[model samples]
Target: MASPLDRGGLPGHRVSVSPLDTAAAARHVATTEDGQRLSLAEQVAQVPTDPGCYLWKDASGEVIYVGKAKNLRARMKQYVQLTDDREKIPLMMQLVASFDYIVVDNEHEALVLERNLIGQYHPYFNVDYKDDKSYPYIAVTHGDVFPAIKYTREKHKPKTRYYGPYTDARAARETIDTIRKVTPICSATCAEWKRVRRLLDKRPDDAGIIGLICAQKGRPCFDYHVGRGPGVCAGMISPEEYAVNVRRVERFLSGHRSELTRELKEDMSEAAAELDFERAGRIKRRLDVVDGLDDRQQVVFPTSVDIDLIGFYREETIAGACVFAVREGRTVRTCEFIVDKGLDVAEDELVAGFVKRYYDETADIPAEVDVAVDLEDADVIGQWLSAKRGRKCTVHRPQRGEKRHLLETCERNARHALMRYMMRTGYADDRTNQALLQLESALALDGPPMRIECFDISTLHGRFTVASMVVFTDGRPDKSQYRRFKIRTELDEANDFASMSEVLGRRYAPERMADERFGSRPDLLVVDGGKPQLTAAMRQLEQLGLDIPVCGLAKADEEVFVPWDDTPVVLPSGSASLYLMKQVRDESHRFAITFHRELRDRAMTVSVLDEVEGVGPTRKRAIMRHFGSMKRLRAATVDEIAAVKGIPAAVAQAVYDTLRA
Candidate 1:
């Protein structure tokens, strides 16, 4: 007995098609070179003694590495003369056939160009993320009246400021959670906060109403009694006051650890002077969080100065960077980045290259940077960092002192990270390779399912139709290749069949085969359903005159459906092959759910506003700010609405009429 969703029917599926893919396509990255072969030494001889970025091409003349230099000649010399300092140097030099350099106005320009080229080329030797969204940002949705500090991915959105392309998503979230202990900001979506806000604002004096709403919200959200919220939803804190709290969070995350604490202390004293006990206590708690962390920082200097101590280590199989974020004379946090260079690259170049990638991806950069590696073009790197920070920056290898000791500590950390990376990669490879092999044998495919793609559609009662395409490369999430869609179909009824058809059709459409999302066809395509869904996917591939293995993982009894078979192929329960299938299916479901929630939340806020002719975003903000709540504006007399600063009498009357209707 199979449930409807797990069987031949798809009663709860949809096509999520969005016009937003156009914006994503605009950021499409590709290599700039024509794969021209040139002599390495000859090209190096032509390089000027000026600041610039250089690209090293393999024998095939494809860029394997990108590096920047203060003096092009001095930096290029390091590559030609191999050093035992790096194990990869000999290997890289063997492959070096030709190279090119982009002359820039300054070291700053060179650094910027290096980043751009790496993003475009994704050189094998550069520290690059497999997926764009791999780094998570603690995003403040300042675009909304009630901003929330939450985990958000960066894709350059408007009105929202992002912090840290934090290398570790868990660490980023942990930092935010710790911040909430001192200055509580809303973690809810704008619509959710707005609903609670309206209720509390309209009944400002009603303590009972606040209790009822907060209780209904349960333990997970906005507990004013526990002070997990700044009392915003209950109208206990003014919007202006909440903005100040959010600013503190921004400053803390922006690497202003010492400066932010001083401000918090001053603000606490002011609150105490005014006899605002609660406000003073809240500020004190924030001070405690800043002062009380187990930072493991040895007091190197009595006076505080911002610095980032960096070190790198390379093993036969793996290489890594250890970055100690020293703020106000203390090491506040440590970040480690490790990657397997496809081609052998020298350790010195790797350190320089990693530094560029890290600072470019993250918002936090220090005024003074100390490195264990010589970094040949330290002055150029410092100049570029200075420009980025709108202040002076110094990048240098430390002489004997506390700075040298810190670099030693950073190097030790890098060694530990290298060991961990080696262990993890070996274990991960065994599990993933075994799973892929098992999956291949079970499916009887042409080869291992190294790159498997799963598609799942999500919608709420035919609203905000959306779909997710999740990619797993080598049996690990390749988030960079993940694609999202908002489907457009004129259906009087919800149809999983049609939704699957539309999403699959658009994905494999002849024009899309050359597109990055579709150009690299998956080794295996797994749809989230049974016979009908499997057929819908196969039909699309057939229409496109393509032949790729397709299957469906029906939720009912964990049955799998292949095009050639009428009956399902149910893998052994709890088997590794089946677990791999379930993992992909679940991931697609989760990705689709998040997109669906975002769309629904957006509609809850914008649909009503969109209907009001006189109320664009500007006018609407004024109205919300003026009345404090939409409930108030709905009940307001025309004169009260007209009295709002930005609204004319005619506009106010129109707004009043619209709300009344």
Candidate 2:
């Protein structure tokens, strides 16, 4: 581990933190939320060039942002000279009074610590990092007498051997089928075996009843005949034999083809020498099949490093990303996500943004992230990955060689996924178009509901008030336009109507409303509750002088409420328009509840010491005695704050910086 002090004087690293250039940082600090007068540049200069996660705190000692860097000092410097076009950065900067960091041993450790702290703190500006969906892993119930090997959409369950979110579900099924053919392991659906013991009581012990129940060919299941599939029927494949075959299945799934084949070949020879001709013949056939499969998987990378090839395909409102897991230089697993109404950022920016969020908390970041699109923060992200993996990770654009070929394959898959996605939804699906048209008529809007915004509030008896604004563009989620808010007013009071009003006011405030993006008219506005919510929004729009169409969707019966009417405009129970509203409302609810939980979590972690800088009990009492409330002290100017007994001018400036931001 390196020293936790400045490493600016050392060699081979960019020392972003330089001694306080008071003129540059102090002025900016005063206008920030922290209101503290510490020179950020100076603070950066003091930060050691070490692996760690940095926390940006505001005047109230609230963590506003969290990020990790291999070189803490250098990363801090990057922020001090911010050219952040991601509008939120400027807002976050305004509240950043002071910065703190946790040093760790390596980059991988830093990644882990960073994610842990983010979940713990829930910083205001940090994007909520959650894997929206998890892929299927073949969960081999190793703990059971009958180890059921099947595809599971969930990840991480105790006492199970899981392999390959494996990308393509079809490919995984095919692989499992092939493995079963080679060595028929018991493959039974949970439902098939759920009440076997109870059902078996009526059957005779002498009859072949167990096999009839478990091994009987059922539809396209068992992959092979009952006897060949080694279907774990009552008397077939003992626990010992089944365990042996399960190990082989695990090896093959993990991409250890060569080693597994070698072991099989040795076993076949030994069996033949022992005069076990049938067993030897079976082994020979299985080995040949495994060898043939390996031959088809031509090695891509010359050196056997596991790398993931990532590719992107975007057109207009739809974009797709494909990730190909190259294990031992073979493309083994493939997965994709089709993003609807994604950000209108550049190709590289899109790739960078997706990659960051995709593996932001993934502990298993590949050593070489071969991206088809050059990442904007390749070096920074690579450092973070390297730290997470406990080894240096290389992230760069791959243009030529085998790596490039793999990336091209990924791009092809991505394009296909996007085409399939569009085909299933958008213009190809007449129902979607009908739904949008129906929504417009149902809400009596000016035109089709091309863009609809929905609001939902979530809190526990109004404690951690949070609201989510979810946007739907052309009847599909426009995630980039979504926003979450921590309701700052009326703390300790549960007021949905009031919170709804505040969110609307801040969302469409005059200054922000001037921006075309913010001002562009939403075709429809749907609130997640009934008359009271609808009235609140209707009155808010009147106050803002905006004549936007608004309605409320109550869950009790999927009823819609509009202004000037107590009776809701109820649609058919099975109407498509109602479905769209339900989706929008549900999405908003999910978003709000998620954000609210984070706020509650952050509140739980805060301590009184977080509010003041360099102030202990003695100074705390003196300041409290003089100002009474912390809010009163925050309103004081630097000189007035300095005038307090036991307070220094520098500390007073820090206080001013903290309070103002």
Candidate 3:
């Protein structure tokens, strides 16, 4: 094995530990000593004058950066010369890692790979980084039973109407909002409105129903009010109409671009014939927008069965694979994930592995499987799945036809889609999205909160009290950042406020928050409650001198609160901001309740066993395991319980008596 000192003679070798500059790192790789298999001059002698991607790695076989080169030889030589300033090349060179290159046939391929790799490894110093702002998509929940149109940075649902994957989310949102003003679909579900109308027309203690009726009927909603008049939504769209619109959206999202295009065109013509120029203009513009989108689709075909098509490419540690599921040849699910590949697996295998891992437990699966490359054991997987579901399962790798071309086009799309998602989520290059960027802006903080701590408390009958703290970095959930605390300080009493304070104190007591990897002072703190709870949190932070700006989410009113602020900031109840807070609060609640239930169940389950002197936890576990669940155990005959590995008949009889009593 090569000693660490083997890198001592490399240029900029000692400067890597300091603050790293991305541009400087790229520059350093360009000028550093040739740690290649051949000398710089020798490698340059054979350099191919082709467009391709160049890779730079440190001595330890880690990808530090990936770049595209229009001229492989020239780009390679620039690094060989070592003439750049130390400031530019300093940190990257300090690692003095070896490097490699792949010569693609064209600059486009190189560009594609460069984006793919950067997104995959997210090297510390790769410039031209992609951010979420660079990709956006239009979301039409209108695909669901009660559809709401919106814009999304990332889609969580498949087969939803998603437009663009646009380079600008704000623009997309503005456009969609404008369109919504023209068409105000009722936000209330059929069930909700029906219940409300029934209760208002008759019943009253159903104040919740009455409140909803008043809210919807007192004035035109924001969407309707935005348009010319209350006439926009004088009557809620009937279920039939809603279903028709949903089917149209489904068709559009299923990759039936022409269907969406046709609808837009028809709407435009109808508006024109009705002498509604403004409405006509809206429809016309939408037509143009849909047309523009349709033209951008890499594959356009009409078919029946839904299928997920996938493809892949890789350079060293960085690999890129794209998966696009097509329903009747229209793309329903287009996604890409960046991963590392040390094994020499085929691109097809990589795609398959990703599909399995990603959709392992997914509730939705396409009807057909499509691919660009065939797997060796497709039958094994297909058979296993078929037997499991009692359905015919076939995996097809199309060759030499429209299907093949479609698959290939989908593969290309998958590549770009993966790259775009990586960039948007800041996942390419294995980096966290600045979750705190929004938090900082919302709170006006000096810097991004590298560590964000949110606390939630859960209790049942003032027993089994528990609190959980969930961490978010860069706007995404980080499970590793999660921490849980059992309410131990006050055993017999459940004081949520005190429990919260104790958990927060335990988490930040220097001994916990002082670890560099695990320890960073939160720029922002959130508590899962309204004003009073927030006040309690503030006092705790103040007492600790943590002095972090704290806020609380009120579940009842769906408001965000800062202490001393009289009026709570009310975010749109369904806005992404609200959604995020809901997720955080829900996660914290889930974690706390999960821990609480474990304690409660453990005590509850074992107490019944412990009442029997001869029975212990081991024998109890054996009985429960054999019986499957508590219900089964309760219903099991004493003889059946006794048959469990270690439970004696007397112990089983005692347990039976204890449970019955």
Best by lDDT: 1
Better of 1 and 2 by lDDT: 1
lDDT of 2 by residue, 1-661 (tens): 1322233212343223222223454455323456654466666676788887788888886777777788888887777767544434544676777766767666655654565565567665554322345665676777565566777776455567676555568877887778776666656453444344334445546233454555454222343354345545444555567678778777677565667778888999999999999989888888778777768876777776778788878654347888887777776667787653233335665576556655643444567888876665687678777765678888878778888877888889888987887677554356568788887787777789888999998878878888999999888899988888888887576899999999998887787678765636688899999999999998898899998889999999678998856789986433457667888999999999889887775564233425668777677667668886656776778888888899888877776776666
**What's the true lDDT of residue 628 in model 1?**
72
Question: How close is every model to the real structure, measured as TM-score?
Answer: 0.48, 0.45, 0.38
What's the lDDT of the predicted structure labeled candidate 3? 0.59
Worst lDDT run of 10 residues, candidate 3, spans 12-21
lDDT of 3 by residue, 11-121 (tens): 222112101124354344434456323444454545567776666677776777665577877876666565533232444555645555656655544544454555556
Question: For model 1, how big is the CA root-mean-square deviation?
Answer: 31.7
- Compared with the true structure, all predictions reach lDDT values of 0.72, 0.70, 0.59
Q: Model 2 — TM-score against the truth?
A: 0.45
Clash counts for all predictions? 11, 23, 21
